[model samples]
Target: MPSVHIRYDNLKPAVKQVLFGRLRLESTRWASFKSWYQFSAFYCAPGEAGAHEKGGVEHEGGRFRRKHLVPPPQVDSLAELNERLAAIDVAEDARHIHGRPTSIGFDFEAERDRLRPLPDDDYDCGIDLTPTVARNSRITVRQGYYSVPAKFIGQKVRVKLRANELWVFDGRQVVARHPRLTRRYTYHDFLDHYLEILLVKPGAFAGASALAQARAEGGFTKVHEAFWAAAKQKAGDREGTRMLIEVLLLHRQLPAEALVKAMETCLRIGSVSTDLVAIEARKAMEGTDDDDAELLTGDGPADDAGGESAGQEAAGARVISLHARRLPPDPRTTLPDMSKYDRLLNLGTARETSQNQKGQGA
Candidate 1:
């Protein structure tokens, strides 16, 4: 998600005009393509050079690509490509190669001028970006499901879908694209997408519509259902479906092991409350701090900045200690007593009456 913060007082007029009064830039000079461009249109005198007029984009792009892209060994995987690109960016930004006299790093540190920042709102360029997958596989977007070809079930098919239109791609090859539906409930009807989701959580998705159809036509539902049933039994939770859904949601941001632990905790408790699962996942993530049990239990002191209590093993660890002090005597002891107090005071007379009766009997 891209977020933008706009402040007119810090923005240059040209950039502001481009943003159309919708956003603000954070700084007067900002880094683009590894070079700095000064936003001069806002504060410059008439007939002075502006951002585009100074050939800023052209100059910056050339230096950035040359410095970052052409490193010695070529990268192969997309993951490696992105990693290498980041490394190059860090290195170039740290040095002072661009005849700007000061290191780009130092200049950034020293400068405090403001322009509009990047907008936090999702930008819609109107280009279709559907990631394609095989007919058997499933892909997710915004917590919803979509389908692709079955042959590509295990393989990755890129969805080129944007916020509006959905597209799928098998590498550079475009397979299928469609306009995304406005609602989420309809997404599950996409057979291939449901099949893919079933692969991850067969128990919860066993009776799902797509799987039901596949079972009727292909006779595979029994096998899948058995697997899901076994998984549910192992988890020992009646709310397997809810737990599975929660696990899927968490898988987006957490590691597989952490999510698995979270699911286990949810199943054990027979509840899929997001709050409880999050607590367990954090505990699993931090790996059971022996000195910070309270942290894991979510009962650490409000001011426990030192994660010291985070792993405390004791159930009732004392975070704060109170000192012993003398207190004043009760004022009621010095005051005259009420009639109720007289009854207790007359207990001796009642006992003597009982004794006199016993002596007369004797």
Candidate 2:
């Protein structure tokens, strides 16, 4: 018998009793992958090592790459490279292979209805790990530290590490989510995650990495800093920071824009009271649509509908207007006379109605 060759050099250990491919031995991991997709594996005949390469199967990929990707593309990120590759693939679908009457796309379109439907449930193509939270309320994932809620400190959390995001779960409940760090040993933090700990150790709030990250990320606005400065000045650092943390905790229940607006409201009156901020936060939220919150976000006036600046109109969404395809004025039908209503309302005749309608023949 010839030795088995696998694409993966690091195949995980398989089921002890289960075996396949004429004593080639399948790993459990490989078996599970195949079973999930309902895929069947066929290998070379016994004592025929070169049999699998009979169709030039392995060389097709190399040939395709050389043909399509001969000149390496310059891209800023993997996302950009993938986008470029997708465009290239779409372009190649129109290409006519040698001896084929129809283009690749035409053949594919003809057979598309015959292809098997994809699995209903999506496969999670992400790495999973369980990491214990450190004293700093952080977990090390692929040499990158990510902050979790302080309540989970010293406890193990399950993490799903995806291509661009990391999701931290305490049991089935998601506790934290952060963008995956591109650099090794780098860390990402959220200010809300550290609020509970900061409340107890008020002195730490000023120098906390989470606080710095929040400020840089626009989550901590100038309004928050202004409120904090006022609170500290009025009540001193220890007491003031504790109060700020209390207000920060409200973020779990309230929207960020509400908190920002509430902070601004309180700061206007020189108050650092957490109770007042809560009152204002609720007031800011009363009768408010979720989308309206974007306008009030404290960083600045954000772009509104049609990319217009927020300051264009405070009550813009309420302004109603009607528009439609312009039907040319029928020379036979006279325009409605609004002069009577306009005169009664004392707004003056609304642009003199067409006196020349009859003269402009139908």
Candidate 3:
């Protein structure tokens, strides 16, 4: 099977528009390719008369029939039909033609050289490179940085770079070229080229590589460490112990100010649970809705709603009292001392006499 890739460059836009309307287009047949390239498919039979001369079976024979030979059917719009046809042509060409020598199916392989060359780097493939400058004086491209000339600072400069290489251009002239870097913090040092920009926006780390380097060498961790140590010191022993957690939680979406307020409330109540902090933070903004209040305060609906409610509330308090009685007191704080005399006094006279007899017998 013979196939050919025809570049639509020679055809005028008007004529090309008509052909595209008649034929189907494959936009992503080579998706990596810019939109300038297009293709169509054809099939050939062994006995077909024009098999060798016309580059196998032209897949677009139906298009020729519908558009040129037969009564052209009315479409929603001529332009719309053309668009549909351009896409269809691409899809048809994207398929593997039958009776190929190789089983590994790739159209580029069979008719490799026949396809049109991609437009030259200079060619404006109608790509929207609408120029805009770097506000931060640095912009990240593929985990690397190519310094823009000093003049392009604080203004948009068009970046035209291809795979494995990048160019920072000031309008027409190429300002900088750097092999793209891939890791975080491994600075693509056009330092000589961009040191002035760097001096201005010291905190504005552009690429992943630069960010990683800053983390590794720029003391971000040390700053946090110093802050935490100072916090722990100020919190004084156990009170400041939760400050470490506060430090970490601050990194999340909840504002630090809200967290500090929540921590202060926690400290006031002598309770420092991270879970509690989150709950209180949410409560501050949106007052605890019915369910949350009920949960936190252990307030629930009375079984006898119509009856005297005070007794039920009292009962609930008593239940809480009983549970508290069963619970072990904190080891860190003072509690009632248990001694032999205390037990005897609590037991009363008859029990004391029995204890004395048992002690004597022992």
Candidate 4:
């Protein structure tokens, strides 16, 4: 946590500005570098420096590569590779150094006690960029397209690109987030983002990238396909697709696994109605039985004739009809008469006429 010595080559703009004490370095303009300035002091080695200038660091790099990465371990993911490297580091910590009396682990423990504690706040290492959402509700970052909410189409948004994920912000509020895609020209889409638009154009939902990704990820289960086919058979293609869209929209309110399970149960029963699907999906989400749910939803069938009459007699409930109430007349208040106002108007006219006649006689 003391001062760090780094090579001058490939220096960040903030570090360069702080070291050189100038707004422009060589021909590059300095950008906001508040993050680098807040932490430990930085010392840059001379340009084109020899290995002897940073001998310890250079030697350590070679030792690490030879000791741990020589064979180049094969791993499925970056997480797995990091796990292997961490294990290697822990194992190496027990080995004694060339001149040291104790192991590297002991030395590190002794030095760590004397070193300064880390700062309270972790540094923000993400790169921030502003990208406008395309009309198709996607934003391109580093040649990889990511979907935002369709409502944000044609609007500029802030993107924070981290090592493993990307956070999207519309102003201060985060609107969308996705795992970072390393492949160029690849897209990460969420089916929920396209649901609103797909409802209006059901045909486009079949060929949508979001749906395709969902299928690839197994999020679109076999039950969904079965239900869609059944719906299409019952209704036409467009109406069936719309029905499917309604089912998909349930994902907004229900857990995905629950919705899929409900769809599976519906498929087993050969029920393809959207209403049935919604009822079953809600039951699944609430972890309730079908009969109980039917009763609660008021969709359960009535009992047999004798059972119904018996139940009605046992309940003894009466239905009351509601009628509009009429207001009573008030005897204390009466309408104003117009005759007094008319006499006042005639008196004013007679005064005006007498004044005009007297002026003519004079």
> Largest lDDT belongs to which candidate?
4
TM-score of each: 0.28, 0.59, 0.25, 0.64
Any idea what lDDT model 1 has?
0.51
Show where candidate 1 strays beyond 4 Å.
Answer: 1-60, 71-80, 98-100, 109-112, 120-122, 125-362
Off by over 4 Å in 4: 2-14, 17-39, 42-44, 47-50, 53-55, 63-106, 290-362
Candidate 2 residue-wise lDDT, 1-362, digit = tens: 11223332222343333245434577655677656566555444433554453455447668778987788776644566678889988998998977899998999888787655656876665678999999998999999999989888889889999876899987788888888776789899898888877788999889998888888878888888888888889999899888888988999999988888888867754567999888878877884323233333333232335344334455453322222212355676667988887787654333233435545765
Which residue pairs collide in model 2, if any? 14-28
* Runs of candidate 2 exceeding 4 Å displacement: 1-27, 41-108, 288-362
Using TM-score as the measure, name the better of candidate 1 and candidate 3: 1
All candidates: CA RMSD (Å): 17.6, 18.3, 19.2, 15.1
lDDT of candidate 2 at residue 182, scale 0 to 100: 69
User: Which one is best on TM-score?
Assistant: 4
In angstroms, how far off is 309's CA in candidate 4? 22
Kindly list the per-residue Cα lDDT of model 3 for residues 1-362, writing each as its tens digit.
12344333222321322233235333432333323344343322223443554543254566557654366545543355566667766665555445764443365576766656654554332222324445434556655545555556667766765544566777688776655554554434343344344435433323324334435544235433444355456665433434443444443557545555555555544455557667666655564433434433556543344354557656763222123323477787675577988778777987878999999999
Candidate 4 local Cα displacement, residue 349, angstroms: 73
Clash list (residue pairs), candidate 4 = none
Candidate 4 displacement at residue 52 in angstroms:
3.8
lDDT of 1 by residue, 117-216 (tens): 5355534433433443435456666555666655666676556546456677777776555546555644533444453355565565645776555455
Ranking by lDDT: 4, 2, 1, 3
Reference-based lDDT, residue 337, model 3: 71
Error of 4 at 56 (Å): 3.4
